[model samples]
Target: MAFDSLGRFGVWRGYTGFSPEEAREYEQLGYGTLWLGGSPPADLPGVESLLAATETITVATSIVNIWVAPAKEVAASFHRIEAGFPGRFLLGIGAGHPEHTGEYRKPYDALVEYLDELDAAGVPAERRAVAALGPRVLKLAADRSAGALPYFVPSAHTAKARTLMGSNALLATENKVVLTDDTNTARTVADPAIQLYLGLTNYVSNLRRFGFTDADLAIPPSDRLFDAVVAHGTPEQVVARLTEHVDAGADHVAVQVLGDDYLPALRTLAPLLAARS
Candidate 1:
């Protein structure tokens, strides 16, 4: 029942980019939570600002990277947010990519150690989640935190994750969407983001697990892989794909509207997604 607080859908954006004004608009559009990505600062004043701007929409970190944001500082910040905003903040933490972390070694062990720190610092397990992609970390997320917030994944991944995490834990999947009917246009708009993840070992490994080959991960990703990872087309068609995620066992879908402008797409899908949820 704790997962119910997240509603059926949320809006995902980079923490440094989205304004507090836009956060209010997301809540108005019926999204239940706002996920701040890009490993926000440990203090999380941006999360606080968004919470202060809105009334009830939950604010979650898509992740605060363990390497960048220390556990004690993040815990103190979580307590600060909880005091002011109460149950509106959900802490999502992760090991981040080895490519990005200079000290990255034994990520699983590091994540376990980070969780131990959070636990000692009094960050309740129910109030946090892990940015888990693989089976081992997914199970760890279920055992330690509230659940899993898996990013850049498809419904098949969601279905597999749900099987690993079981019924009690939260399964909030992050799905990217492009608002256009033309396949070529959609792929062009999404390719930059897709290309970025293609280089990341964690994302690449997860996609490989789901049957994506090295050819699919090449510079210009294959349409099959692109379509599998990103939902595109009319609002209705995109909503249909989003519904597939929900049907596949996601408790909540954090929609990342790709492209320069997020509002127009988010605005268009609000009512259509509302109807489905």
Candidate 2:
């Protein structure tokens, strides 16, 4: 189970600017895994440091968009990274959005074909996962790859996903959290990222699966939508929200700090979480 490979919780913060040594510090600080989400260039050089620095923490691609990262390029990177760091790497690839790239095809078919290429190139299914959010993709993740690494989903979706896939598939769900008491500023910082996802059909479809209406996923994230998926408040409160996800069904709760500066937010929780853990 990927369950044992992960910590009780993981930080899904940015790796956009941090050097690999910095990631090592986060690993030393007791964060089990780092999920790189900003879709950094698909290369092994960037991942090598993160894998080499920490002996235990698993550095994963929260997702590498298939549009930008071809299977051959990813396969080459996989072999290079795995040769050096062994099991410390996990490949997460997904078809991002039809709108973002006008050349998008039948994503499900594309994903399967991509997985086939990875398999042919000797990437083990156990060492890779897909960015999945719906029933078909989730099932595909279970049947083919290691599991699904779903982003921007609520605890309800996690629970439902677990029920659908049972104890077999790895359920790693990312949650956008803020370490603040002020609702307005937090939402203001969060609204941009949230709105960027508003038009993604895959994400919107996933929301609908969880009983959210079209109105719920409009331009700005509604209160019900925000309250359901995003967790805001103190570290303790955020932890409480994470606990709800764990209780519901998630195996790993990857936290994305919902503000401009995530370092302060992570630093605030690091000591307390590390000490208690």
Candidate 3:
């Protein structure tokens, strides 16, 4: 997998909230890729919109949930996007949370089946990625897709993922960021943002692997857990934390800035990311 196409870092945000204008600005700011977070549908016109808005930036789904969107449909969407944009789109697929997905069965098996369908539908393995955390799924990502796209994890998890997937595969991890120097304010802003993941077993399990105790994963995440997951501080501080993933062998880091307004933070961190590149 050629991660150079994705550059060293990218912006990860929800598809619904952002505009084409903002995406173009990110491209101008020198970010390599733009990932649309959340479980997007199979017909990813949003991918088309972003690609049309930008010139060279790669646009990918942070994850398109397999339980909700069928693989054949997703593959068709992939082909449609590829035809129009060529090498600019990546199909990121996952078997989302069991609690949230009504039809969620054995996620690993379902993911394999979905990959099989993508293969049958002519979506090449290199053009797609899997959102994985555990060793089993991470190995599967290495074997089946381009690599693993692990979310809600710390730098330690990135190191473990790189070790599991080896050097050839892509290990793109998403790190949450809040541009603030005050610890209390940063935690307060991050608390609600992270509350949703606390109920999900998959994320909780991954956090435990990072040595987070039950107290840390409580309703309002403990400072230890929040600090570890969210890179909260100045632009330089956030860049330092993001670099931890790169040093740990991550191929790319998709930064998800916390809070409603993302432009100010993106503007603040753009130069820092570009400098690291």
Clashes of each: 0, 0, 0
Query: Residue 216's C-alpha lDDT in candidate 2?
Result: 85
Candidate 1 ranges with C-alpha deviation above 4 Å: none
Candidate 2's displacement at residue 234, Å, is 1.6
Q: Per-prediction RMSD in angstroms?
A: 0.9, 1.9, 0.9
* Model 1 C-alpha lDDT versus the unseen true structure: 0.92
Could you give the candidate ranking by TM-score, starting with the highest?
1, 3, 2
Top candidate by lDDT: 1
Alpha-carbon shift of residue 38 in model 1 (angstroms): 0.6
Among residues 3 or more apart in sequence or in different chains, the pairs in candidate 3 whose N, CA or C atoms overlap within 3 Å are none
lDDT of 3: 0.91
- Between candidates 1 and 3, the lDDT winner: 1
lDDT of 2 by residue, 1-277 (tens): 2666877667785556556776877777777788888665667446787777678988888788888888888899998988888788888888888988878999999999999989998899998888888888889988888888988888988888888778977888899887887888778878888888877788888899888987889878788898777788788777778777878887777878876677777877776565444
- Residue 181 of candidate 3: its Cα lDDT? 97
